[model samples]
Target chain A: MTTGTASARTRLDPARRRTQLLDLGVGLLATRTLDELTIDLLAERAGISRGLLYHYFGGKHAFHEAVVRRAVEDLVAQTAPPAGGEPLERLLASMTSYVDYVTANYEGYASIVRAAQGGHEALRRLHEQARNVLTDRIFTEDAQGAVIPDTPATRLAVRGWSAMTEELVLTWAADPGPVTRDQLLAAVTGSLPALVDLLR
Target chain B: MTTGTASARTRLDPARRRTQLLDLGVGLLATRTLDELTIDLLAERAGISRGLLYHYFGGKHAFHEAVVRRAVEDLVAQTAPPAGGEPLERLLASMTSYVDYVTANYEGYASIVRAAQGGHEALRRLHEQARNVLTDRIFTEDAQGAVIPDTPATRLAVRGWSAMTEELVLTWAADPGPVTRDQLLAAVTGSLPALVDLLR
Candidate 1:
């Protein structure tokens, strides 16, 4: 029953179908609020039977959780701390990577945030898992790697930076045109040395 | 027909009625999803006539917006830095106030956040207005009081602090028990000396 394009038809393998569903879901999420996203419409738009969606995810909540997990995983991978550099330099590099990731995948990022706000319990778990991993990475890899002592001061520094990064990115996502990616990166890097000193 | 004890009877005034309705909205918001808050239910539990609610707010959306605005304004007011204090001290004080405000009004804050996420344009406007006021207060009042010069670095320092405060409060509101309010306040204060150096 596909009526539009050739690429839309033959790309119906299970992997492709799953990707297609996520893509459709992400697109819908951008223009419409999450409350309105329904399984029937997601399946209809993806050119897949409703049964197939259930086959893959068992339910819409599961599908949503899967989508959120993938998004968070991608974000974490993109912002993973750099190795073999000076601590401050590596931390700066990671912040640059993080800004780039959020700017590029702003929609997916926003969707995960919205889900974290009030989505299903599974989405909350996925969000928490991603946060825990990222926070741990910052503590062990970024802040500690810089030779910053593991004192309470350093811990506070890391938490402050982490908090600001999320806040700035969230605002940027809401209105990207006003706050460019460069400004965001500069904001993070510009504040890093001061953050590093807290560890000392 | 008014009913119940002295505490309930005291809320029959127009201003208190509005407050009661909004508080009830916040209460309902925590238990049920935002999409479920309706005028009839709000009015019924509020023990106020539907006509009176409409008179106070024009409609459900207006009432919701007012409630969000009131909560945000309260937060902004409470978090504003006190005059005649050192920049760092004032910043710490502001952070403590913010943490306390969010912790005390977790559900009300969540309701506003949920309403904003729902693409409620009026609520978004109110939220942004409160944020801009906070940002401006930090720059004009708090940052102006800093011993450091008002350079770009100083501005960015304020920005970093502002971002951290907002993000920490938002995360805290979403999940209150994991991070204690004192821990968050201490974390920000501990990072301040380093952050101030960056600004200078």
Candidate 2:
């Protein structure tokens, strides 16, 4: 009876357990760098043994990769353009949504950027995927709705635009003044026409 | 006699010794992040005692700050415009020189970028100083010697341009294909007029 009670208390469905662990990781990332995140600490926080944590994540690197992949995916989902509007308006809406998301999730944004800098191939690939999705959205669907032909030069220019937006947004989120959010939003959105022209 | 030999071997003029230590630190940064860098390794490599390393740098954090500041200063010096050319030509030349410097000193640039991401106030300030210098050169001196008033919006745009250049350059350096150096350089240089237009 005692053994059955302990087992019932400890058991969690696999999907729910995974979500629980990821939520814990995302929360911890608010205050700590990936390097500072340790399995021991994570396990302790989750009230699980180290072995149990490893059973779920395999190791810290994998866990980090998972966290980063999920973060990027969440960012993409959050910034996805709303359906049915003029392409330009949708682009602005997406950019506005991105700024809002970053402002709201400064820690998460910083963590993802830090992870991208970490020289891990897995993390770099995840970052690239996010960039590619954003670029495709801008170039394929949002640049006046006629799909722009993709070339190396166009790709590079699109990436440049994305990078500029990311850097400016991150800077603004970190500091939050000097340039008001409206000004920042306008500057980024205004740059889009120039970016499109450059690609052309 | 042994004591005299030991003292002679160990003694270095303070300026010379500081340069030597900085050089060592820079070289080490080529392979290791500041977090991975340790006083013990630096001391061992420099053939000095840990106490002596501290005597010069107080501790690891200060040492990292000094290293990052010097690196940024060196980057600024290396990219400083050459004397007396057409403003546009000099801008292109400066861009060329910057690409050359970053490609040549990839590790140093990575170290500076990593330091910027480290959430250290000193590092972020040093990064801002570097960005300001580059922005001033581009807006005040290089853009046809027309002094653009540095409003917050203008400042943000200039910094955005700078950040775009950096991210693209860093990405090109790391990947080095699909876009040739000439193409990358031209793409970045071509965007300058548009950036200027946006700021206007």
Candidate 3:
């Protein structure tokens, strides 16, 4: 029986094992901050040895970067705007989706925010990528149309608007009662026209 | 002569010693992140014994909190609006001071910004205090006068605006001249009236 169990574990493909580990990481992030994550604890939880975990991630920092990157990718996927709508309608849809994603995945949102502020190089790159994608969607093209010409000022405005949206969503997620989701969505999207005007 | 040197070091008052240690920390922050700071390095830089440094700060975390608090206080003082001006003028003056402070003290600004994102409890509190003071000045009363009523929405707007301002200043500090300081200042303050309008 012991030999059979060992053989089954060893037979797990590397890709499958990696995915399993990453899924465990995502689950753990729901309850723990990235800073609090440890390889030993994860290994124990997975019923594997620390050596096996390190074989997959090399170290805690590497594992953390992977987790952060995955989270950011997930966020981008979750918030992607649907096809074929008016620009304003698309913008509003995107904003609502963003708030919904944040509220539903508070831990992932928190992790991304925390990592964006002077985290490791990979994590920071992932953060910038996420921001750029959102900015591109909002400024370069939207469902309604290409609303703004891509200029330096437009880029700055988009980035600023992105930052504002993030801060508002984070605040709302932490305490939902103070402001309803609709109010939060309205506040964020309503401010965009003014932001575009300022950029112009 | 050795005894004399030792005696002179020991003769430094506790208040003076604490100040000396904190000043070293401030200097180190110019080149290192707060998490990178160490008592051993500080003691060596200050030509004090490790025990003496520990005497002033029980641990590295405590020392970091003290340094962050001091930096935040210094930032508040540096950015305080000059007394008795129109609200718009006062707001602009305050914004200019903020930009100047951030440009001159990039490291400190970075540290404060980083700390505001999931740092120690004390550092986070100090950051909120700094933000509150700035937000209050902007929303409650200035030379121009109280432009917005103090409501939940108003508070949210002020906070969102503050975060936007911080992100802009930090970006400008990293690479100046793409947007002139005046442009950055104008961008931030110009967006505020609109934000207030949106909130209303």
Candidate 4:
């Protein structure tokens, strides 16, 4: 019985080790570029056997994808609009939420962003998910006359507005300067009326 | 006399070797992530001895920085505002120029963008140089607007506008939809007066 218990403990150790490896790999990704990350380096950092590392993740690409997926989920969760605000207010709140998310989790956010450059299907899905949320907010806002638009114009307007919000969040993350959260929120809000009219 | 001739060839070789290394490194960077970029690989790609590579670039960081700086200068040169046009026309023309530049050279542009996240001082300087050019255009357009106040609000407005423009360009490059060049130009032009008002 004692011998059997010893074997079970040994088996469970590897599974625990694998989980630890995934966590470390994902955590490091936030701070380092994808290309800079190496399996040997990751194994060393995670205190795992390189052979076992391969068993757990298959390879670096798979590991990186997992990290990216988590970031996408996090970003979507962080920026989801409030339930009962006016359309414009909801949009503004969502934009500010995104900025705050970027500021606080820049490492993870940046990694996912860099990984998304390629036509990675998972990343694309994540992007489309975010776009859909923004689109809903824009449509609601437009219906309220907070954002003016016909279909084509409104679609273009939201696209442009999102384009700006995404870019500013990225820039502020890259360099935290006098461009405060308040500044970015105001700037995005300021553009909404023009965005609505442009759509019309 | 033979020794002297050999010395002259050796002296000339270093600069030629450095240029060759930069060419190879830059070419790879256009398509690959910085983490994937390695000195051993770069030396092999350049067909130079590792010793010669060190002699030219000092190390990987310096080499990466130089490649980034070269890419930035090229982008700035390509997208510099057209020599003369109306403020709105000039803005649209510059956006068109930007679209052309990125479409033609996105790999290099993407690489520079990746480098920006590192937030190295040199990278920050490159970003500032690019921003200054865009800011100048914003100022030019805003000058004609009698109502737009030249205050902190105006600065934030211009910065936000530029951020949006940059974001849309990057996104379009990543995913070119039905919004053709003419359509994009018209939408942006239609929205300009509202953008001007938001600053005021």
DockQ of each model against the real complex?
A: 0.20, 0.25, 0.35, 0.17
Per candidate, the number of residue pairs that clash is 0, 0, 6, 5
lDDT of 3 by residue, B15-134 (tens): 977887787788777667676678888888888788877778888788888887777777778778777777777778888988887777787668767766653567767788888888
Give the Å error, residue A72, model 1. Answer: 2.4
Docking class of 4: incorrect
TM-score of each: 0.64, 0.69, 0.79, 0.57
TM-score of 4: 0.57
**Chain A TM-score per candidate?**
0.71, 0.84, 0.86, 0.71
What would the TM-score be for candidate 3 when compared with the true structure?
0.79
Number of the predicted model whose DockQ against the real structure is largest: 3
User: lDDT values of the candidates?
Assistant: 0.65, 0.75, 0.75, 0.65
Off by over 4 Å in 2: A1-12, A20-68, A82-87, A118-128, A136-148, A174-183, A190-193, A196-200, B1-12, B20-69, B82-90, B119-128, B136-147, B175-183, B190-193, B196-200
Please state the Cα-based DockQ of model 2 relative to the true two-chain complex: 0.25
Provide all candidates' interface root-mean-square deviations: 5.5, 3.4, 2.3, 5.1
What order do you get sorting by lDDT, best first? Answer: 3, 2, 1, 4
Q: List, residue by residue over B1-200, the lDDT tens digit for candidate 1.
A: 55777766665787877776777776665555455667777878877678877898897777777766666766777888877767768877887887777666665565666556435667767866776787667667644455444555454555556667665566656665544566666655665444555435
Note the B-chain TM-score for every model: 0.70, 0.85, 0.86, 0.73
TM-score of model 1 (CA atoms): 0.64
Candidate 2, position B136, lDDT:
80
Question: Distance from true position, residue B97, model 1, in Å?
Answer: 3.4
**How well is each residue in A113-198 modelled by candidate 2, as lDDT tens digits?**
75675446587678878888888887667445343456666666677788888888887788876677877777787776666555
Off by over 4 Å in 1: A1-64, A119-122, A140-160, A170-200, B1-65, B83-93, B103-124, B142-160, B169-200
